[model samples]
Target: MNTIVSTYNLSKYFNGICRVNEVNLTVYEGDIYGFLGPNGAGKSTTLKMLLGLIKPTKGNMVIFSKNFNKNRQLILSQTGSLIESPSYYEHLTGLENMRILQRLRNVSNKKVQEALHIVRLEKQQNKLVKHYSLGMKQRLGIAMALINFPKLLILDEPTNGLDPNGIREIRELIKSLPQRYGITVLISTHLLSEIEQIATSVGIINDGNLLFQGSMEQLKAKNKAYISIKTQDNNLAKKILLTEGYKFKQNNDRLIFEDLTDSHIAYLNKLFIGQSIDVIRIEEHRKSLEDIFLELTGKERSL
Candidate 1:
């Protein structure tokens, strides 16, 4: 796949305070790249620089394999974005809003219809914006961004204020875009679950630093599977294991260990049973994406 967007040592500052430190982002064609971080982790700042909404303090940005600064018009023409909350005339119908954007973008009525259809908003296109639900309004924003049929779509926290149903709707929409429209998507969010659902690639950031970037599979491969042992007599079990020279991690109520086979589990179970320790449960667990995100970003969150 071709590189659609990239940054070299991208940095941003506000009032001499660093909002985004030296960071590099690479987005490939037809990929749903999730830009994930905690709140105020420079996810939005990095995206703003990519869209030229804000100027970078330093570093270079490249999109469509062309320098952003050198080919600003050409690059922006093929890029669409909906940042934070989209502003609209509440009195106007969704179609009317799209018509206004159509005139501005110099696109035809067919394109407007197509955009609405892409966002699954055709049925509600004639409804007044004020009468629409939050999710509908958000889809409308996405439709407006799609009016020009951009090859790359940038969305900042698209599911920010959405309910579960709305988030699911948007997630399905985003997941479909790559295969449906051949458009590469760059979506920024603080939720790992959101990315796990829609993104093919990921970039994790924290405290103005880019902590990790890779395919979703690569990131998930870091999730280790371990065996957890819960017993009625955990203290006695711990002692028996320590005496037998076993390595493990202990939580409040369970004993956790890794790199063991089913045979080992059987052996341990047998041993514990023989020693009069009642084995309540023995389960294998895999760390979730959220767990890995917390580990990478540090256990203590910003807020």
Candidate 2:
């Protein structure tokens, strides 16, 4: 796949404090690359630098295989972005707002309707921006970004303020872009579940530092699976597990084992039965994306 966006040792500083440090990011064509991190982890700062909204303190970036420093205009022409909340003329109708952007971008007027249709806002194009609901406004913002039919779309927290249905709608739209329009998407968010659903690849950052970057499958492979077991006699179960030298941890009223085979489970069941200890429950537990995200970033608070 073609490399759509690439950064090398990308760093940003504010008031002599490094907000982004030695970060390396690669986004390939046709990929929905999820840029993930906790709050104040430089996700937004790095995205701003990528969009040429702010200059990096050190290192450089390349977009569409062109050096950002030298070909900023050329690169930006093919890139469309929405950072934070979108700005709009409250008095203008959706169509009117699109017309303004069309004029500024020097693109054909037909693109206005096309963008509106893509965002499912064509029916509401005649409505004033101020009257639009939060979800409608967000779709309008995306329509504005799509008016140019950009090759790469960068959205920072696109679903930030959306309700569950709105989030689902946006996620579906974003997931469809690569297949329907052949557009590469780079989305930044603190939500791990959202990334797990739509992103082809992900980069995790924390405290201005990059922690993990790879395909979702690779990240999941790093997480160990465990089995939770509950027995009628917890004391006897513990003694049996200890006698067998099995590695496990006690959580509340259950014992968890990281490495347990089907045969091992069977043997344990038989052993318990022979000893007249009832086995109440036994189940395997796999780590979720949120679990891995929290562990990798070493943060207790939710994203």
The alpha-carbon RMSD values of the candidates against the true structure, listed in the order shown, are 2.8, 2.4
lDDT of 2 by residue, 1-303 (tens): 899999999999999999999999999999999999888899999999998889899998988889999999999989899999887898999999999999999989788888999999989999999999999999999999998999999999999989999999999999999999999999999888899899999999999999999887888888788899899998998998899888889999898988799999899889988899999999899977777888889875344
The lDDT values for all models are 0.92, 0.92
The residue pairs found clashing in candidate 1 are: none
Clashes found in each candidate (C-alpha, N, C closer than 3 A) = 0, 0
Per-residue lDDT tens digits for candidate 1, residues 1-303, read 799998999999999999999999999999999999999899988988998989999999999999999999999999999999877899999999999988888999899999999889999998999999999999999999889989999999999889999999999999988898888999999888899888999999998999999999999999989999999999999999999888999987989998988888999999999998899999999988878899999844332
Q: How does model 2 score by TM-score?
A: 0.90
Task: Give me the runs in candidate 2 sitting further than 4 Å from their true place.
Answer: 230-255, 275-281, 300-303
Model 2: which residue pairs collide? none
Ten consecutive residues with minimal summed lDDT in candidate 1? 294-303
